[model samples]
Target: MSDSDLYATHTVENQPQVLLPYNLWSADRMLVHAVQQNHSDLPTSTLTDFGNIAGDQLMNAGELANKNKPHFQPFDRYGRRIDNVEFHPAYHELMGEAMTAQVHAYSWKNESTTGSHVIRAALLFMHSQADAGTTCPLTMTHAGVAALRNAPDLPRYWADKVISGEYDPRSIPASQKRGITLGMGMTEKQGGSDVRRNTTRADIQADGSYRITGHKFFFSAPMCDAHLILAQSTKGLSCFLLPRILEDGSLNHVRIQRLKDKLGDWSNASSEVEFQGATAHLVGEEGRGVPVIIDMVSLTRLDCMIGSTSLMRQALVQALHHTQHREAFGAKLIEQPLMKNVLADLTLEVAASLALTMRVARAVDLAKANQHEAHLSRIATAIGKYWICKRTPAFVNEAQECLGGIGYVEENILPRLYRQAPLNSIWEGSANVQCLDVLRALRKEPEAINALFVELQKAVGKNSAYDKHIENLKAAFDEQETLEIRSRLLVEQMALALQGALLLNADDKDMAEAFCLARLGKQQGLVFGTLPASVPFDEIIQRGKLEN
Candidate 1:
């Protein structure tokens, strides 16, 4: 079957189905374009080179996945894209590279609005393909690995151009570039988090393909191009790489009858997908799908952590800018001692979140480079995802406090960021679920924790503030005698300290120190059953000044 025929047939067959409102899609596209333009910067030739490679691959894959763009009319009941879909780095190759540069550029002028738009565009494209049943070739499993490895071939076609450090972002037209979108069809409505109980059946067809029949309730990015779907194949509970489009690049049997009215990420279309014998291809071996999918989930969860941290960083930046500029009671808001403390605390939190995110990213990179133990990669990925995902929302909320009334306003980005922040923790895996996984890994491989501790000890040896935090963490670990209690507390404290250290190590050393000290003080108060009677507030203040 030709790709065009397949698309036409699928569209005709699904014509009766409700089409996504076009205005919504247009509004979203407009917002993305505006943001991208607002944030445009001189491309980092080096990063652009890397991006070109990935971009070329995506372009080829997208072309091969020939699908129609579904209209997205951005409007609420009252006709508005109030909850605009913020762009991300994950989708656009150029934008992703741009984000990497932004992190390292250290030039305020390098900050551009385009990165977010590229992400949003990719997400929208995914949604459109999901609605159309076009196969998503940009499998999250391989994509995650590619991202971490910074493999030029992984992003494929544009590899040499991107890696050559001479690619131009402007040369790539927005219309030609595919947008970023994700697929979520993992939850078994009956079994909840237990994939083993998933009864969704996939029977091998005569043509070597499988027909999947079942219902998935909590599917996110259901309308995306590719979905890492879970099902019961012949081997056991497994994952399948199901695309909205078929191999010929046409809509498959997937159907999206309803759109979710989400609490956040509203612009990103999410829906409950019903597969009435949807066509699918088995990923890896049959029974290995679940583990493979879990691996993908771990990496995604890590990305979610970075995303959350990014949100917090953006929120903090906005809040600080507001406070510094906005005056009340005849003084700038930041000048107030209480506000100062709030800003200080927020700064610490944001810094910590950034450090933790970088640490996880590096760990992911290291694991990819070594290619030694899948188990180790899995554990490290889980740890990174769980720790940062849990902390990002908290940081955002605290930062929001700095914005005061403005934070609550819909127009102010904080409220949107705050609402979106919580989704990361819930998605990939919940906090409790991740904690249990951590405990399981620790119990199964005690050496993972020990190895991590050894690394932490090395970090503590440094004279930086993170070293002090590690020292305090070690003190706490040593103080506990009970195996069970100590293990639990140690995990919690270590997660915090490790994240602090990672953040410090990756992005900003000075900010990391400030954050580590702040965390140490907060933790000391909680763990020791009393706040320091006389916190060396002056010392902390002095340290903060020196760091800043």
Candidate 2:
């Protein structure tokens, strides 16, 4: 079949219309194009490595570049054309933890880095296939836990693939390279942030499977081969691994009713999926999916942080390039003090964000290595997710402003970054949810808080920037006397402290400290802003000092 015909075959209009528009072809093209662009910067050796692992035909940069040129006809609802791109089946084999590390590093570079998502999707897809005993190189932390609970030998299977790189998912003819997408199903028609009120239900079947029946208000890649679905199991609110395609390799009973007209990540599909007796395999166990998924969710949260950092970095680079050459008022924009400060601030914050994210990634790696501190790693992940998710959008917005009107145009990547950054915090878990989790984790084991503080103290002792920030944080903590106030202050301090520890561990101690300093300064402003003017500044200072 011709490329056009193949693309046309994937359109949703041709399929039985479910609740949301099902356009796998468009989504596929977007993902393919993004992945193609992602590999553009790689050397031939790396490309060959990817091809060797994937065992499928890998498109080189030249072919990908040719395919990525915007075409008007195959545009999605968002007006973004699908870039015709293809990846070798071995892409999954090539994307192991090291690749994740590389992608994470790239995210630190700038906002235009589209490789993170590609790597992420590849990892998750590989993860699913690996879990099913199909050969794939990628490994996940929760996979072991799930294996212990369900499939005991699964970890060994994963280890062999990772160590030898000899496994091929396509080798199992019955198990093809299936497309996978990750999305949160927390939102409901009634409440979004309040997931406790979610009404999705799962009824048990005689065959030991589940008949999941509920409406997912916002589902990403609903038509993908597999989904990490959230549902209310018999135990409580939980998550399940729901395959879009059944064991018979047919589309499940779930219906995709509508595709959301989102502002950014336009190439990716976000749909409202309605499950009508959809069959699902319970991941982990009953009442255990929430925490289990939360662990997995941390990976995505870290991705969001890194993705935003990458986008901001790209925006800053582009802005700098444009400002350096484009003269305004007979002087380059970078020559002006105001523009120079903006540039400096953008550069600094982007660096800080990158440093913070990498720290989290390293912590995640450490947790995986030592397995004993998995909980601590989860907390660190939350901190990373919360801090970066909150800052990325602001950084993107500020970076866009530096470009003035040009940044708002779709032609420039800033607007897309800006639109996509917010979804990072909202997905995986919102900022508030992360903060609450931090609070809950602290409450569960107060020693974790002290341990975190000690880690920060050690980091501070080594680095001057961190030392200064810690002093400020100590002062802020000392000021709050009420238990309620102390807990809140500690939560904020914990975030800063963890950020410092991660950065220190990641070998970027200075940038992490600077970010904590910025955060401390901002928090002070917020505290001062809310205080009564009649109150003495000294009293406020005194209270802050007391907490430390």
Q: Please tell me which predicted candidate would have the highest lDDT against the true structure.
A: 1
TM per model? 0.64, 0.64
Give per-model CA RMSD.
Answer: 15.4, 14.6
Indicate the residue-level lDDT of 397 in model 1: 76
lDDT of each: 0.49, 0.49
Query: Can you tell me which runs of candidate 2 are displaced by over 4 Å?
Result: 1-186, 191-193, 369-376, 462-468, 472-548
How many clashing residue pairs appear in each of the predictions shown? Answer: 40, 23
Candidate 2 per-residue lDDT over residues 68-108, each given as its tens digit: 32122234469653211223323332333223323212222
Model 1 C-alpha RMSD vs. true structure (Å) is 15.4
| lDDT at residue 34 of model 1 (Cα atoms) | 24
Q: Candidate 2, after superposition: displacement of residue 377 in Å?
A: 2.3
